[model samples]
Target: MSPRVRGEEQPGFFEVLGTWLPRQPWFRAPRGRLSLTRVGGLRLPTPAGDSDSRVFLELHIFEVAHQDGPVRISVPVALRSRPSAIAGKSAFIGKLTSPEHGELWVYDGAGDRAFLAAWIEMSRREQGSRNGRSRGRAHAGFAFGSPWTLELRRTGADAPKEGVTRSIVRREHADSQGEHDRDEIVMDLLRRPAGEQDELLESLITLSEANCEVIPKVLGTIDGAWKQKDDADDAGYWVSGILGVIREAGISGPDGTSIMRRALQAGDDLSDSARAAGRAVGTFHADLAGSFGAHPQTQEQLRIMTANVQSTLTQQWEQVRSEFDDDEAADLNEVIDLMRMQLRDADEPLMLQQIHGDLGAEHLHRTAGDAWVIREPEGLMSHALGLRDVVTVLISAADAVMSVAAETPEILRAAAEQEAAEAEQEGQSDAPAEPVNFGQWYEEFTQAFLSGYRESDADSAGVDSVFFRAAMLTEALDLFRRWRGQWVFRPSMLLQVDN
Candidate 1:
C-alpha cells in the first residue's frame, strides 16, 4: 500500500485524492497525491441548535489546488449533518452510522441554501420577469435544479441555525498548511515562475491605495500579508455576512443568460440578459487589469509554462482521442499547429495579463448593470491566452444548451465510416456512409457559443485557442477509443507526412 502523507497524528481529512479527485471535472491530474496546507480561512458556526455537529456544523474547507502548473482553484467545502439514506453515485463522500437514526454519509448540508437562496432572491428582486428574466417563472426553478459543482450542496430549504453569526472574517494562518497560505501560495503556485512576490504585492497595494469601489475590494488577506497602505480595511480576517448581499442578488431578477441562447431555445430576453452579463465580464476584466496593472509577461516568462502546456497536451491527448475521428483528428492537429504558431507570434503583451481562466454565465455574482464584480476569492489561475477563458466558457455553455441529438460515442463511429465511404466512392474501397460531418454538431454547437465571445472584438481570435485545446481533447478521446476497443484513424494519419 502506498504510504499516506497525512491523517496519522492529525485529524483525518480523507483520502479523497484517489476515490474522489478523478471524478471531478475540474481536477486536472489523472492522479496525484493531495497535500493539505493552510491557505487562509475562517470558521463560522451559529451558536444555535444542537451544536451536536449534525444540525449545526459548517466548516469552510478553503482549499488551494497545488498540483503542478498555474491552475489555482478555491474549494469551499461545507459539511452538515443530515437525516440518513441519501446514498447514490456520490455515496455522501463517506458514511457513518450515528447513534441517532441510521447510516449518514458526510454530505453538503449548507449546499446551495444560503448561496442559492441569496442568488434567487437577488435575481427576482432585480427583475420581476417584466424584463423577461426569471426563466419565464416556469423554468426559473428548473434552471436551478441540476447541481452545479461551483455551487455549494445545500439545495433544499434547510435553514441555518438561528443566531448563527451571519458571517465571520478569517485571517491567513501562520501554519503552512494549504489552508493558511492559500492566497500567498496561489501566486507562488500559479503565477509566472520568475514573477516576484514583491511585484504582485506592489500591484495589490496600488489597488488598495486607489480605494477602487467599482472593482472588488480586497477585504484584507487572511493574514496581514496584503495589508493596505491606508490600513483601513484590515480587520484581522473576520467573516462578514455575505448572506444579505447574496440573497438580495438572487431575487434581483434575470441578470444574465447564456450567449448561445438561440441554439438552446433561449429567447431575446435571455440573450439580452446575457449580453448585459457579458458587459459585466468586460468591466470586471478591465478592472482587474487596472487594479493589478496591465503588466504582461516577459518573453523569458513564456518559456516557463510552454513546456508544461506541451506536455499536458501530449499526455491528455493520448487518453481521449476516441472522442473524435480521422478527419476531426487531422483537422484538430492542423488547427493546433497553426494556433501554436500564431500564439508564438502574438505572444505579446495581452496574452500574459491576469485573467480569469474560467468564465461563464454561472460565474457571475450579479449583472454589471446591477452590481457585480470578480469573485477574487477564486484567485488567479495560470492559463493560456486570454482568449482561452472566453472560448471555454462559450463551449461549456453550448454543451449545456445543446440537445445532444447524436450520442458522442456514436458520432465517432460515424466519422470513421464516413471516411471509409468517401474513400470507396473515390474508387479506393467500398464502405457504408458515415454520418455527414459527424463533428459538425460540436462545431456548430461551439460556434453558436462563440457568438457572444466574438461579439467583443478583443476576444474573437480566441477561437483559435479552442482549436489547439481541442487537439489535446482529441488525443484524449483517441485514448478513450483505444480503451473501448472501438477505433479510428492512426495518429500518423493525423500527422503531416514528409515528402
Candidate 2:
C-alpha cells in the first residue's frame, strides 16, 4: 500500500509539533514562534503482527521560516495510543487529541524501535524489490511525472536482529545519533538535508564498496526526493538527499571509556594505542585512495594552499599582536617566518586523495581486544593532501595533552609551597626539583603515531617534514586566534617544529 498523509484527518497534529519541534536538540531554528508549513512527508508501514499495531510511524518535512531564509527540517514521529515506557521522557513529544484515533501520545521516531525497524526494512526492500513505488497525491503543473521517490540502499551484508531496543545519543554535532540494542547498530539521522552533495553517505558507500575494515560498517542509507510546499503536484521537485545512515557501533573498552578520554587520563601510556590508531588511519587513507584513486600534487593546488596558509597567518598575527609583548611577538614572527620558508621550500612529491577532513582522538576508539576502530568519517574531502588528516590528529593530540599539562605548573607550585612550609617548621632546607618536560611526551607520541603510519602503508614512503611543519604552524595560529591567552604559547611548545 502507498503511504498516506493523515495530518488533515488528525486534529492538532501541527499544533503539537510546533510546541515540540523547537525544544528538540536536533531542531536548528531560533527559539521563538516559528512559521512552520508542511512541505512533504511519508508514513512508513510497520511490520506484520507487531506488538504495537496501533502505533503510527511517520517522517514529516516542514519548511520553517526565519529571518535569513526558509529551512526544511525532518521530524520522524511515532504516534501511540498511550505513552511508551521504553521511549522515556526525553523522547516524548506533546500529546495530541486526534478525532479519528482518540487521545494519542507522540514520540520522536528516531528513538522508537518501531520506527527504526520500519525504516531499515524499507531500505532493505529497496535493495531487493523492483516493484517498490513511492506514491502520493498529484496536482497540476508538476515538474516531475512520478510521485515522491525514495532511494534507500542497504550496504551491509548482515541484517539487524529482531526486537532490538533503541536509544538516542546526543552529541555536540549537527546530526542525531541513535543506538540500537546495546551497540548493535548506530544510526545517524542527518538533520540538514543536502540536496545532492551528501558527502557522508557518498564517502560511506565508497568505503563500504571497497571493504574498508578500519571504518564502522555501513548498514544502510535513506535518501530521496520530496515535493516542495509550492509545488503544483505531489511529484517531488525538491531532493532530500541522505536523510539517515545505519552503521555498526564501535566497540569500546571494558570500562566503556573512550580512547580519547583514556589518553587524557594516562598520556604516558598512550604510545601503543596511539600507534594502533595511527596505523588504522593510515590503512583507512590507503583504502580511500584505492577506492577513489590518488593523484600527484599539482602546482595549482600547491599555490592555492600556500595562499590560504598565508592569508590565515596574516589574519591571526593581526588578531594576536596586541596580546603579546615584544619578546613574544618576536617568537611568533620567527615561527611564522619559519612556516613561510617551509611552505616555499616544500618541493617533495606528495599524493593527493580523499581525506578525513576532521580526524581527532574523539573519532578513534580502541576495542577490548586492542584493535582500533575509526568512527565519524562524515567530514570527508574529495581531494586534499593526506597530511592534512595527520596534522589534524597531531593537533588534537597536542590539545589533549596541553589541557592536562596546563595545570601542572600551579599544582607543582602548591606542592612545593607545602613542602617548604613543612621544612621551615622542622628547621630543614630542601632543594627544588627540576621542572617536568611535558613536551617530551607529545614528541614521543608523535613519533609513535608516524611510525605506525609508515608501518601500515608502504606507499607512504615518508611524510614531507617541511609541509608537515608548515601545516602545524598554520593550525597553531588558527588555534591561538580562537583560544587567545589559553593557547598563546602552548602551540609553539608542543609543536616543536623548529627542532
Candidate 3:
C-alpha cells in the first residue's frame, strides 16, 4: 500500500488539466493558448472506511482566459487508483502521481457511473459544498441554501449530451395493476459554470412548488460556486440542478412542429391540433402570469417592442433580398416598406408579462394522453408584452404552413413525373395521386389556434390588430431569411405582408 498524499503534497492538478481542457466541446476558446485559474469546486461522498477504495469525486471550477475574455467552466473530476478502473476511454483525463496516494487515474466525472449516481444522491439530499485544496487552502465548503426540499422517487442512468450537459431520468410506477409506468425526474447538468442564479428556471421551480401543470416540477437544484473577485470568500458560480422532465405520462412526445408537418404532408385537417397547441400555450402564459404577476404595457415597453421588431426585420431583409431574384427582391422591399409603416401605428398600450420568448411549435410537446407541456424556457422575456408570445406563435405557425404548402405542389409534380417515367418502363398506367388542399387547412388551423388562444385565461382583449399585424410582418421577414437560407421559401411567405 502507498502512503496517502497530504493536502499540501498533492500534485499540480491544473498542469494536467491544461492539456485535457481543450479536448472538451464546451471549451469555447479559439484553438490557441489558455491561462487557467482554480476558482472553486465541490466534493461528492465516496465510499468510506475501505482501505482498498481509492475513488474520489470532486467538481473543479476554473476561470480560463483567452484573447476575448475570461470564461468560467466546471469540470467534474474523478480520481481512481488504476487506469482500468476509469469508467470509459472517453472519460480519461490524465494520469498523475500523488505524493500520498501514489499513482492516480483521472477521468471526467460526467462519464463515470459512480459519479452520476452520487450526483443524483447529492442533489436529492441538497448537499452542496466545496472540497479539496485549491489556491493553497485546505477546507471543506458547503452549499448556499437549506437542504433540497424536493425528492425524486427513482433515478435512471443517463449519458451526457454533446460534451456540455447530461440528464438522468426519474420514474414513477403506475398505481393500476396492468398500467404502465413512466419517468418523472429529469436532472440537468450544465458542464460550464453559470454566473448567477437562473431566474427563469427559478420561476419554474417556484411554479412547480405551487403545483403548476404547465411548468415542469423542479425536484431540486444543485449548484457549485467558488470565491472569485470579492474580498469576502463567497460561493459564486452556479453549476447544475435537477428538474422534473416535462413529458406526457413519461412519453416525451413529438413537438408541435413535427406534428403540423405530418398533417400537412398527409393533407389531414390540422384545426384540432393547432387549437390544442394554442390553448396549451395560453395555459402556460396564464400560469406564468399567475405565478410571477403581470406588468402594465407601458408606452416605453411598446416602443421597445416595435423598435426591436423593426431592427430585426430590417437586418433580416438584407439577407432575404440577397437570395431572391431582382423582381422578387423588389416585391419584398415594397412589403418591408409597408411593414415599417404599420409599425408606426402601434401606439396603444397593452398588458405585459413574463413570457416564453421562444414559443414555437418545436418548443411545445403534445402527449398521446392529450396533454401539452412546455418543454423548456429557452428564451424568457420577463417584461415582454403578453401579446408578443401570441403573435410569435401565430407567425411561426403561419410561416410553417405557408412554406410547406408552397413547396408541396412542386414536390408532387416531381413525384408525378417520376411515376410516369416508371410507368412507361413497365407499360402500365400511373397511380392516381391524392390532392392536398393547403389553403383550406391553413385557414382552419389559423382560425382555431387564434380562437383557442383568445379563449384561454391569458389577457388578449387589448392586443391591437395593427400591432399584431406589424409583429407578424416582422416575424415573417425573419422566417423568410431562415427559409431562404434553407432553400425552402417561395414569394408566398413575403405575401404575408398584405395581412
Candidate 4:
C-alpha cells in the first residue's frame, strides 16, 4: 500500500493541481493564489479487462480555500507510466514522480474512456459498498441502488433466454462517464459534500417510480467520506450521485427549447407537444405531492421564502439595472411591486410539497416512446409550493421567446448600421426597425402548459391569479439580472434555480 500519510512525498500532487485548476471553467478563479489541501476523495476502477494494467483513474477532491470562503473542486486524474500515451494535449497536467508509483504522467481523468466505463459499470450494478481502500484516514463508502447494477447486467445476459434482443443499442456519449447504450447509467461527481439537499433526488426517484414516468430510474448514489467532522482532520470528500441515463425514446426530436424556437420561427403548431409537456409536468408535480405528501405553509415559512426571493432579485437587479431605459425600468418596478404585494397577503395557506425545482423544455427530453422525460432537478429539490415549478417553466418559456426575438433585431441592426455607414457617402440613411409582435407564441404556450396541468387532475388550490402574477414577476426579476450593460442573453431555459 502507498504511504497512508498525505504529506509523504506524493509527487507534489497539490502543487501540480494549484497550477492546473484555475484554468478550468468550473473551478472559480480565486482573487489571489489558491491554498489547496487534499481533504479526501474516491476512485472508480478501470473496467475488468483492459489492454493496459498500469493506467489508474482517481477523482481527487480538494477544499480550495480563498479569502471569500472554502469551495471544493474534484479533479479526475489518469495516472500512467508513459506520459506520451495520453492522446489529448489539453488533458495533460504536470508530470510527477511518486515515491510508491514512480514517474507518473497525470492527465484529466474525464478524458479517459476507461474511467467513464468504470463509473457506468458501478451505476449499472448499483454497487454501494465501501470495498475500495481510501488513501488517507477518510473512510469513504459507495452506496448503489434504484434499478441495481446486478439487475442491469442481468438484463443484458438474460435477453436471449427471454427470446428477445434488447433493442436499446449501445451508443456512447462523452461527459463525466463515457460509453452508454440507448439507455444507460450516468455518474455525476458532486464537487461538494452530500447534504440534506442530496436526498431530494433519491426521494423523487423512489416516489416517481410509483406515481409517474417522468423521471429516469435512479441507478445509485455513492457517499464519500461518510463521517462526522470531529475537527479539521475529519473533513473529506463528501458525496456523489449516480443515476440511469435517460435515452432518447422518440422517433426524432430536438430539445424542448429548440423545438419552441423552431415552432416560433416556422409558425408551426406546437400545441400537441406543449400540451403533453405541460401534462407531464403537472402529473410529475402531482405525483411528488401524492407520494411524499406536503404540509400547509406556515406564515413564517412564507415570509422566509418571500425574503429569499426578494433578496436574490435585489442582488441580480443591482448588477443589471443600468441596462433598462426609464420606461422599461418603471415597468419592471411595477412588476416587483406586484410581487411584493402578492407575497404580503395570502387568501389561504399554500400547500408546500417537493417539486422538480428546475423545469423547462430544455431539461425535458422527448423519448423514442413519444413520452416526455425530465432531467436535471436543481436547488433544494425538497419542499416548497408546487407553483415554484410552474413559475420557473413559465419564465423559461418567456426567456426562449426573448432569445428568438432578440436575435432578429440584432441581425437587422448590424445590417442597418453597415448600410448607414455606406449611405453616409451617398447622403441616404435608413435605421433598422424594432421587432414587433414580441413573444407571439407566449399565450399559446402558456395556455397549452396550463391546460395539460388542469387535464392531469392536479390540485388547483395552490394556484391562483395572485400567486401566478407574483411568480411571473419574480421570474421577470430573475431575467432582468441578465439585461445589464449589453443585453447578453442569460438562457433562462438552461439555468437551474439555486436555492
Question: Model 4 TM-score?
Answer: 0.59
Tens digits of lDDT, candidate 3, 12-131:
677677888877766776557667777666667663432327777777677777666667677877777777432667788888886567787787776665565566557554454544
- Which candidate tops TM-score? 2
Question: What is the per-residue lDDT of model 1 for residues 361-430, given as tens digits with 9 covering 90 to 100?
Answer: 4454452345443333234644345655554444444333332222434544655667777887798765
Best by lDDT: 2
- The whole-model C-alpha lDDT of candidate 4 against the native structure comes to 0.56
Model 2 ranges with Cα > 4 A deviation: 1-8, 28-36, 48-50, 65-69, 98-100, 127-183, 191-194, 229-240, 251-267, 298-347, 375-379, 409-437, 462-465, 469-499
Q: Using Cα atoms with residue i matched to residue i, what is each candidate's TM-score against the true structure?
A: 0.37, 0.68, 0.67, 0.59
RMSD (CA, Å), each prediction: 17.7, 10.1, 8.4, 11.9
Please give the lDDT score for candidate 1. 0.36
Badly placed stretches (over 4 Å) of model 3 are: 1-12, 29-35, 47-53, 68-70, 82-86, 97-103, 130-163, 168-185, 230-253, 295-349, 367-370, 375-379, 409-433, 462-499
* Candidate 4 wrong stretches, greater than 4 Å: 1-14, 28-37, 63-72, 83-87, 98-102, 128-185, 194-199, 208-212, 226-255, 295-352, 356-370, 375-377, 380-388, 395-399, 402-440, 460-499
Poorly placed runs, candidate 1 (over 4 Å):
1-274, 340-351, 365-385, 402-499
lDDT of 2 by residue, 392-492 (tens): 88888777665655566575676567767888898887755444455676677778788888877625633546666666766766665565455555433
By lDDT: ranked, best first = 2, 3, 4, 1
RMSD of 1: 17.7
